[model samples]
Target chain A: MGELRLMKGNEALAEAAVRAGSDGYFGYPITPQSEVIEYLMAEKPFERTGMVVLQAESEVAAINMLYGGGGTGKKVMTSSSSPGISLMQEGLSYMAGAEIPCIVANIVRGGPGLGDIQPAQSDYFQSVKGGGHGDYRLPVLAPASVQEMSDFVPISYDLAFKYRTPVLIVSDGLIGQMMEKVELFDQMPRITDKEINEKYPWATNGKPKGKERRILTSLDLDPHKLEKHNFHLQDKYKQIEANEVRYELIDCDDAEYIIVAYGSSSRISQKAIQLARAEGIKVGILRLITLWPFPKKPIDELVIKGIKGFLAVEMSAGQMVEDVKLTVRERTKVEHFGRYGGVIHSPEEVLEALKTKIIGG
Target chain B: MSEIAIQDIIKPENLVYEKTKLMTDKTLSYCPGCGHGTTHRLIMEVIEELGQENETIGVAPVGCSVLAYEFMNVDMQEAAHGRAPAVATAIKRLWPKKVVFTYQGDGDLAAIGTAETIHACNRGEQIVIVFINNGIYGMTGGQMAPTTLPGMKTATSPYGRDIATMGNPLKITELVAQLPGTYYVTRHSVHTAAAARKAKRAIKKAFQNQLDGKPGLSFVEVVSNCNSGWKMEPVQSNIWMEENMFPYYELGDIKVDGKLLSK
Candidate 1:
C-alpha cells in the first residue's frame, strides 16, 4: 500500500512481481520492454527477496526458463515485444497444452517483419488467438494504461496459478514507454506454496510424496490419446470463454453509435466517447480486457440494446473485427477501421471517424 | 558382491516404470542411430539410481528434444528453442529444493538459446545442463547447426559449410567452462562403448552436482552424429564422430570440485 508514485509501465510490472514474492524472473532484453529487465536489475530483487533475476541468452531461453519454473509450481515471468514474442509462441503453446502456470508480457510493436519499436498493438492475433503452433489460447490481458500494466503483473500471476495456464499481459510500446502514476500494492499478507500445491496436485513440481511422478507435457501422438488431449484442450477453452469474458462499456446503454477497441485503440476510444458526448452525439464504447475470450457477451448485450452500429479500431488490418462480427452476426452494421504495417491510429483520427459516422448519425 | 550391496543398486530397466512412467511412455519420434534415445536412457538411469525420479525436473529444449518431456521418465518441462537454461533458472528459483536441468541441442543451445545459456552460466544458478551436439538440425530437415563441421552441407548451406562464410564449428563445452559460475563442464561422445560409458558418467555427474545443492552450472555436451541426416551408415557415423568431431571437441571433465562437493 505505498503512496501513488510516477513510474513507467514496464518498471511497475517488475516491482509488482517482486512485491508478490515471485521466486524467479527470466527474460531477454528487447526494445520498449527492456525497462522491465533494467528495473529488475536495478532493484536487485534477487538479492532482496531470493527472486531469481536472470538476463537470458535470447527470448527463446527466457520463455523456456518460465516453463521450467512453472513446472516446479514456482511463480515465474518473462517480458518482450513483437519479434521477441514471436519466438516465445512455441514455449507458450507447450505451457498451455501442459497446463503450466506462468506470466508472459508482450509490449507489442508494429510487425510482419522487423517493424519499428514504436507503439503498436499489432500482436493482437499473436497473443490472444494462439500465436504459436497447435490449437491453444493464452488468457490474454490487454492493458490500455500504465497503471493497468502495473496492476496486471500481479493479477497475471494469480490468474496463471488459478488456471494452471500461461497468462499474457498484452500491451503496446505506448503503454510500456509512457510514464504514469500508480498505487503499488504491498506484498499480500497471505502467500503460500501449499495452497497451489494442494490445489494443483497434478503439478509435476516434485514427486508428490509417495505418488507416481507427474509429467508436464502436451504430446499425445496416439490417434485416440491425442484426440483426448485435443478434446480436453477444447473443453478448457470453452470453460475460459464461459467464465472469463471482460470488457469496459461506456454510455452504450442509450447510444446509437458503438466503437470497439482494445489496448491503445481502447485509449483512443475513450477520447472519442468524450468528444461524441460533448458534441451531443450518442457514442458508446466497448473496450476489451480479456482479448482471447473476445468479450463477445458485452457486444451481444450492446447489440441487444440496439447500440447503433459498431466500429472496430485496431492497429492491424481488421483482425479482431472478425470476432466482433461473429458476436454481432449482422444484427447491426459493423464497420472496420484499421492501420497496417507500422503506422498507428491517433485519437484524432478516431474522433474524425466519429465525426463522419457517429456525429453524423 | 555382498547381497546388501547388490540389492541396494537398482537396475536401469527398473528405473522408469510405475510412478516415473508418467513422464515417459513407449511412444518415440527420433530416427534410428539417434543418440537422443541413449542419452534419454542415461538420464533416466541417473534419476532412478539417485532416487531423484520424483524430485528431479527436466527442461526439454526445441529440436528433436522438444518432445523430451514426452519421453523422460520424470516431471519434465518443455522450453523454447534454446531457452532451456532460462526455464531451468525459473523452476530452480521457484522451487529451490527441487532438482532442475535442461536438455538442449547444438542449434538450440549454441545458436538460438545462446543468450539464456550464457547468462545462466554467468549467474551460476545451481542447475545442470545436458547439451547434445549432433552437428545438424533433425526436425527441420538437415540444416547447419552452430556446431556443424566445416565442409558439412545442409539444406541451408548445401555446398558444405564453408569457414569463409559460415565460420568454423563452435566448441560450446569449452566456451561454457570458461565462465566462473560453471563448476562442472565436460565434453563426451557416444560413438563407442567406451565413449558411451564415459558419457554416462559425465551425465550422472551433472545430475549429482545439482543434487548436492552446489552453487554452479554443470554442463555435458555429447558429440553425436546424425546418421540419417549425414546420409551415412550408423557405424560410419560413429567413426565420423570419432575421427572428425573429437579432434575439434575434446572430451574429459573440464572442472569438478570433487573435494568441494564432487561432480
Candidate 2:
C-alpha cells in the first residue's frame, strides 16, 4: 500500500520514527543497535520533518533526555542494547513514577554482563517483568519480522500517550541486523507547539498567559500521597491488561502439541511446526506479540480443548516458560528448549527439542 | 514614631524592595541561613525582570533544592540526582525558542553528574546552568562532595578531607570555562549583601546569553555556605567562608564572552 523497500530492521525503525512524526530521538550507540542512530544521522530527519536527533554521551544521559523531552508532551524515543538498557534502569523508574510517555526499543544481545553481540531472548523476564525498580510494568511488544519492526514505532507512541506510560519494543540482534522487505507508513506531521499545549495540559512546555504553571516530578515525601499515586498507576496497568493483549494462534485447532514462542523464536518454531506436521506429529505454534499481558485466555482455551503438551521455545535459558507454566497450571505438560548465550537454534533443533523435552519426557 | 500607620509603610511608592511574584507562596524547604533561598529568589527575579516569566522552563536538581519546582511557580521539571544538565539539554534542543536553565548543587553538578555537566558544556548547548558549590552534600545530611576543600571535615570525612586519599577539589567552573563550547563562565559568592548583588548580575547575564541565542552554554557558579553541615552559627560560617573558602575558591568573573580571564 505505502512505499515498499528492502531495509535492515534497525534502519527501517529509524525511518519509521521520522515518518511517525516523532519530535525528538536521543540515543547512544551500542552493538547490534548502533545502526539506529547511524541511520538517523545519514537520513537527517531534522532537515526533512523538523525532527531532532542527538547522540547522547551515555545511555544514562539518553534516557533522561527522553524524560525531559517527553515531559514537554513531545513524542520522544530511544534505542539501546542489553548492557545499555541496564544502565538506563534508574531513569526508566523515574520516568515511570513521573508518568511520562516515551518509547524505548531494546535490540537484545546476549548478556549477564556484556555476554556477546548475538541474538538472545534472555531479557524476557526483564522486559515483561519490571526491568526498573518499583511496582511498575512496561507494555512490551515483541516483533518477529522487519515489517513489524517498522510498524511498531507508531503503535508504541500511540500506546505510550494513550496510557501516559513508557512502552518497550523488544527485538534482538537477528532482526536488527537482517535485511528484509518492509512497507513504510505514510509520513505524519509533527505536532505544533500550540497543539502540544492543547493536547497535554499537564505538559511542562511553559506557562501560557493566564494559565497555571505545570510541574512534573515523582518525589512525593508523604507516604499516603505516594500510595495513592501507586494505586492510580495500578489501575492504568489493569486497563492495559484488559484491552491490549495481542497474540497469534497458528494451526492451534486439533493440535496435539503447541509450541509457544515470540519474536525470532516464533519464526523458528513456525518452520519446526511444518517438520513435525510432516511426520504426523499434529503440532502447532502460539506466537506472542505482546509479552506483558501474556495472552492467557487463548492458551486456556487450548488447554480446555485437550492439548497434550506445550514446548516453550526461546533463545535463552528459559524465561518465558515460567509464564506459560503459570498459565497452564499443571493442566498440561509445559517444557522449555533453546540454545542460549548467542547460539541460534535451527528448525530441526527445535523439532528435536520438542520431541525430547515434551513428547518423550 | 509610635503612631506611624502600617498602610503608609506598605504603600507602593514607599516600597523600596518587593519579592518577585514569580515565586510561589509555598514555604522554601531550605534552612534559614542557607543560600538556596536567596539564589532561587534571584533567578526568579531575573526571569521576571526580563519579562520572560511565561517563556522559561527550569530543571531542578536532587539536592536540598530538589523541591525547587514547588517554590518556582513557572513550568518546572525535577531531574534525577546529577542529571539536570542532561534533562535541560533535551528541553532546550526540542524547544529552541524557549529559555531553559538548570539549578543544581555541588554534589549534583560536580560529583555524580560530572559526565552530564561536562558533555552538555562540550556540546555548546544553548542553556544556562546555575551551579551552587557548597563543598558538601546538604540534602542527604552533609556527605563529602567533589568540591570539598582539602582538610575540610564532612560526614563522610570525619577526620578532615585527606587530599592524598580523597583527591583534590574540582574547580568545575574553571574546568568548563576552558571548553570551547562555553560562551560565558563565572564564579561568585552570595554570603553577603554586596556579594549577593554581584551574583545576581552574573545570573542575569547567563540568562541573557541564552536569550540572545549565544552559540554556547552559559554557566554561573555561586560558592555558598552550609552552616548546619559545617557545625557553625550563620554569622560565624560566613566569616569562616571569608577567611578560608575565599582564598581557595576565589570569587569574581572567570570568563566573559567566551574568553577566559587571565589570573
Over 4 Å off in model 1, which ranges? A1-3, A189-193, A315-317, A337-349, A358-361, B1-41, B48-51, B62-71, B111-115, B134-167, B190-197, B213-215, B224-245, B256-263
Candidate 2 segments whose C-alpha is farther than 4 A from its true place: none
In terms of DockQ, the best-performing candidate is 2
lDDT of each: 0.81, 0.93
Best by lDDT: 2
Error of 1 at B224 (Å): 4.2
Give the C-alpha miss distance for residue A158 in model 1, angstroms: 3.4
**lDDT tens digits by residue: candidate 1, B126-216:** 9989888989998888889988889987888899999998888888777777788898888888767788789888888888888887778
The candidate 1 chain A region of ten consecutive residues with least summed lDDT is A187-196
Report how closely model 1 matches the true complex, as a DockQ value: 0.54
Can you write out model 1's per-residue Cα lDDT over A265-349, one digit (the tens) per residue? 8887788778778878788888888898788888887888877788898888888888899899999878778777657777777
